[model samples]
Target: MKKNWMALLMGIVMATLLLSACSNEGSSNEADADGGSGEAATEQVLKIGNDQEPAGLDPHKVPAHSSIRIYEKIYDSLLTFDEDMKVQPELAEKWEQPDETTYVFTLREGVKFHNGREMTAEDVKYSFERIMDEETASIAKSYFDKVESIEVVSPTEIKFTLSEPYAPFLSYVASTNAAIVAKEVVEENGDLNQAAVGTGPFKLDEWLPDNHVKLSKNEDYYKDGQPKLDGITYLTMKDESARLAAIRTGEVHVTTLSSQSIPLAEKSDGVEIKSYQSTEYSYVGFNVNKEPFNDVKVRQAISLAVDRKEVADVVWKGDAVLSGPIPESMGQWAIDVSQEELYQQNIEKAKELLAEAGYEDGFETVISTASTYTDMVDTAQLLQQQLEAIGIKAEIKQLEWGQYIDTWTNGDHDMLVGRNSSGSDPDRSIGFFFSTDGSANVWGFSDEKIDQLAEEGRTTIDPEKRVEIYNEAQKRVIEQTPNLFLVSPEKFFIVRDSVDNYSPTANEPENFNDVVIME
Candidate 1:
């Protein structure tokens, strides 16, 4: 009897052990079915080191480049540009031009804002009206000068009436400046300079001024299974060295690398460099309203003095292409005019022109630039040397980006070393700078012929005719010498190997909505 009882006890113990083992196996399988581990199940975050802190959260108020880097992820424009630089639908599912001066847009359905409010045509109207409002003082207002009125036909349909037949209106709508904002949110948050609420792939989570801005994935994003990453954090690393260091230490997943730092990044472990042909060109812009620079001969002389190839080879490490007033990225709109005579380094000709311009002794002037832009600073220094060689005393005045912008916009500087958008369209690229009332015409360059040509180009509906008009305008601009056209530097991004689908556009900001992280 004792043996039988012991056998039974042993059987029970064995049965219990077997059941426990089965339960443990099932739990493991369940966990695996859901996601490998707790860590894997958790949200994936991507950290990026932005070269500079965004000036403001309001897309309408800040500089397009830096602000768009942030706004592109937070807001949705009526239209968006594709890889081919073609206008594609974004918030507007479809659009049509009923007439030369009328555009009708149909909004996407089932789109919800971050505040759980449905987007309507009225919101679009309100957003655009806000930009056009004199009280708003939106920097983007100039871009929409042709917009006469916006009519909300229905909840999903809207129409835009133009004062003239503006050919670049569609492209303008696709630009960062035309990003649609939630009317309710804008109303609630008067300025929207500090906070943002939109129907983008991500929602503003937190903003630690001068440090970082955190964004979380919008679960209710219009596109299904989008914004693969759970969140993104943009760490403001103004110093290029600090940004590179952050990338090396894994503090940041991606950051833009200067041409000089490309070698360093290439040698760094677990770093990958991706290069893109950018639609941005660096140029030495002259305040045409100022002395010496006002003379076309002086401008042309300075343009001839600097060797663009040397600048490209030395300052840009031969990673840039010599560009004209319009970059080659403008497709058919870019006319390859023979600037050989003007771009050639002719010191004697430059001196003769200077002498003719009443600067026989060579005058001294300050070249204002932003210190944060290392490439621009280097280019400015190189330009200073070149100008000195021509007997012109060029003083480099590097200031903080904010101050630099202030001084440049106020037309307080004699010369400005900076980069400007060589947009996909002629109006956006050339007209913005050369047009009589151009918003970016801080140089005070005004020509009736150029203005008339720009107007024709903007109003012409035929692509070929528009191109012809712009080509003429470009020729005139080159002759006027408002800017000493330089090299268009290729943008280099240092990304981690683990990051997937991290393609950035030359014209648009980096989009991380489709990015995913691999273990």
Candidate 2:
């Protein structure tokens, strides 16, 4: 952990100063199709900072949020979600759903990747098939589990044949993982960990792990002089305070802040606050296969004991919304389990349940969290206190982000606070955590009924029926106690006042390319 922290500090220092090598130099006079007449000042350089550092440079091997952000900046997908969170054209100019189980994407014409290689249907098929190969170790493989095969119909057209009627297929491909890559580069490098090539608005110039990544605007970008900034330097810093300080000091142009840091930005000059509802939902997941936790009464008791509102207010500074497993932002698909039916900090009910479950004397348990998110640490500590009050001997362990996540996914702990970034669709969020074989299901929870409902929701063609199926699944899940659904926190961003057009989006990592400095 210390080594990574030091590396992150070094990365930030280097990112702010070092200018990496560029292969091509082009005129900046190209018109901005989005709006501007290519008349912006030529001195634009956006310095973005974040609290987390990429575990590695490989998008295929590393699924961490930090690395994906870098990948998104440099890669293009067959289709991408627009600002409205609807599927829009990217590498694929248009697509058609010929049947319930098959969809065809038409590749854009004359699209050249950073390597000057023209994007063809074969490259698109290769990128999709690679992510599904278990050897690639992509976190996105689970989402594409139903995909049967990818066949190139023509140089400009590719067909995706799925084993089942998957409603979210197109949106799934629109994910950051499905970002199109050059088949030539991946074959030559034979190692995704060291390779980087894409057709996005920027080209990766240099990646110094943990310190910084430098990306110059791709001159041959398909969108034509898109990414208005001359170049973007992503500085990885672990300290939230340091990151906020950098933004205010003008050491960096933008940085993300935690809920607690919102007040600091609100009070400070030369800083702008941007907030949006995050698809993320916080929960306390119990290892349902374990001895005490296996008893649904015991799990419900723990859920009832903790005060979620108190934790959200005191720890998060009331910057978040109280949410169950299904966040309200999910809208129509959101299932209202009701605050009364769910846990509500009732000590008497918790004690009653504990006694009913033959654990009146309480039991010993361990709670785990990562230090990268200080709020998680605080939440764990509070849970420890609350559980102890119920006569349960609770211990808290703080692990580094990498170790923490690995341990959680490997099912090595009793319980942990977890979150999932719900994508554009509710099915995307619901199906991932509750399904029996879900890769992110850390609690080892399995229920045939809930699994069936989730599957039904996924394949159900009718919107109303899908929502009903998902609602039933959510109810069953909330009742099972694998999750003590807590709160939905807002995605907070603090940037320099000079930064304009920083519209916050539903996506956790919103594009900062739209931003420009007043100077």
Candidate 3:
């Protein structure tokens, strides 16, 4: 299984040393930001460690969380999720659902984009219409498929017309995918890939590709006396140990920690580990458009070979629970894969299924994973061992965050290990990934019945009917095996003790507006 006890032990020791070193080296230089160590703490900069570097700054194009982290800083949606995941106002101060198919929103006045132009209802309409446009191919398009039209009522009001009733629509609006953009800016730059102009608390200052993204405070932010920090620096530290080391060395103020690094972070000085339950689920996805996986039996056989419980225990150290196509964080909407026979691992049965699929000797395939996410790497390595038991020779392809995302996004790999956030609703959890036109459906899985049921689940407002629809949908996704559903690990973010008001939100990207770094 490529398990190295020594490497793990060394990793813990190294992680500790790395984080400790950062605190020592950064303390002196960190003082320079405020003029001197003895001077008053001014121009407070919150240095954050990003395990996966953002591929781009565009919200409509890149759905990667790394990119979303920056998007949440640079852009504002009509609505947002509070720390409790309850919907709250953002760009749109208030809204109303006059009917099942209509929504009217009144935009807050004088809210200016990073470029100083006031955000009008036209900008909001343009932002959503751009995503709905077929050419843009936004991954979040499926979530808004019911959006029939958008109309600007006035300079401060926008109206939306839906073709059908979609219960999960509001939650989708709260997603960064629906982030507002400056129409003139997008037209000028071709895209927000290199340039970002949004109405947010922080404005983009400097973005050094593969290095860091620096953001400065928007003095004209709509919120009064908020965004406490003078600036936020997103440091791309792709390695888990390296990130922890950055924390230890005090090179960065905060970073997300993997289960493997939790113990190391917990014991480290000058750090406070804040954790919460999250909607994230990790899975091994098969590109159903490709062979070997093109056949459902092959996909099912491979899925049946791996033990999910073992994966949870070994990888997440029991901090996670077994997940299905829908994650446990979805509550009653999620099916208990532990009770499902399809999720139970059986090498002999898996071999039989492979034989029936005319690959009795098994097949050679690649499992692409991101090098930035160590848990995904560890999961791939363990799956490599488990698959070998059924005679399948699987090669592990570990690429950097950018390449790995590209490989999966373009369906260039047979299979891949990736983790995703499911959000608060089941429709967002399921439709965003497995539905025929699901924005995250890079697995190339498209099914008529699954698509129909997903539509039904969202359109049918009856809670009982929704439960039945999603239940059936979940079972079908499991049987079809587009993805070998794994576990939903808890959220863990390690922060320096100097940082305050650092609570992590369950539904949105990490927002640094309220965070303060004591100099």
Candidate 4:
């Protein structure tokens, strides 16, 4: 009986040994599957899917939002806007306005650019001067046109003297276009279209055109413990379905979605949708220099013929709000022009105005728009149909983005259906379209009275006074009918559940400095 017990114990030992060997083999296979590491895989990289590639890295060269989004990661501005769109210090620690026309900014100490050079007042002065340089032909020059001079008070202090008391000066300084760049880097690189070096939370590591733009965290960032993610990769996926698929399959962590994709995103699991009232304004502009359109009555007739509410509902899928030239996102500066009779759709009045303008049989016009934006194409088609009801023959001319911009810049189009960004401040919203010398005034719609009012709106310091000035300007603009303002479409962002603290502002790009990735 003792011998039998020993045999049974040996058998048991053999079985235990076999089990241990199989467990070891399984663990080895698991490690091999996990890139030869026994520990579970952890991703430190945050991948974002963008619909289009940025035009360039040079902040002054491109006003495209795609470029601005990338710039927000690679550069630092003097000031920045908070979640509430309030001005806040960024590179500048604090600032003081000594007088109506004089402003001083106290630079943050120990700030280092991506190139390891210490930032000083000289860099700030150079950046502003570069923007104002006529040779650069910067699209952002208008924002700083009010500055009379930039003086360096000290290595860490800078003062700006404006030609007038520009109330929106602080907001302009806070813009992404006003990002402070290293003078030495700019000189070495010449254009800074491909390379960028700035004192921000991240540094541009690599940019593969039409592929991805990669950025790595700045370890020596002045803001301590910032940019929690090790790096970020902006993947360019122009096709909307491709972007949605990338997010759904865990290939990308976040992406912006169009209104049509909102329903699909809502039904998808492990995805969260966040939306904000966009400051982008869509409009149908008439080139006042063109024949027939030169007549204010013709412009007014077209504005009265189309229904903004219908456009907002059908095109935007009920995700937009009707707005005037100044979107409601401008807060108190937005004049209540909804009650204005010109804005109402009066078919009879439109026909009467057309008849009065010697177009009793209607007129032939071409509407030019960029085909890159599907919404704009739809808007043009809708406008064409609406105009047809009043015996107007509208031809839709769709062009590529580059051609569209060129046509508009050269004033070669009769009419245009496009969108413009209305920034956080009222000055940025109104000045670019209405000011006589505004770079975006492609329709040649210029009024001396409107220009004076816009000047006063920016120079006036008191809130009430500024509002009064802007209200008068808006009313005049409506009467002139340079553009038929449409709606402010809601902006949507889709993020993975694992991404935390990824909030996007209405006027600014997404700041990922505090973004965290959950395991």
Sort by lDDT, top down from the best: 3, 4, 1, 2
* Among all candidates shown, the one with the greatest TM-score: 1
Q: Report backbone clashes per prediction.
A: 0, 1, 13, 0
Query: For each candidate, what TM-score against the reference?
Result: 0.91, 0.88, 0.90, 0.89
User: In order, what lDDT does every prediction score?
Assistant: 0.84, 0.77, 0.85, 0.85
lDDT, candidate 3, at 431: 80
Put down candidate 1 lDDT per residue, 264-359, tens digits, no spaces: 999989889988888888898898887888899999999888988888898889998888778877778776744657877899999999999888
Candidate 4 weakest lDDT stretch, 10 residues = 32-41
Please write out the lDDT profile of model 2 over residues 317-412, one tens digit for every residue: 887787766787878878664454655678888899999999889999888887787778888988888888688988888888778758766778
- Candidate 1 vs candidate 2: the lDDT winner is 1
Query: Candidate 2: deviation at residue 31, Å?
Result: 12
Model 1: residues >4 Å from true position, as ranges? Answer: 1-43
Error at 88, model 4, angstroms: 1.5
Task: State the lDDT of candidate 3 residue by residue for 239-319, as single tens digits.
Answer: 677898999878888889888789998888999888777788899889888888899999989888998888988889888
Whole-structure CA lDDT of model 1: 0.84
* Candidate 1 local Cα displacement, residue 213, angstroms: 1.0
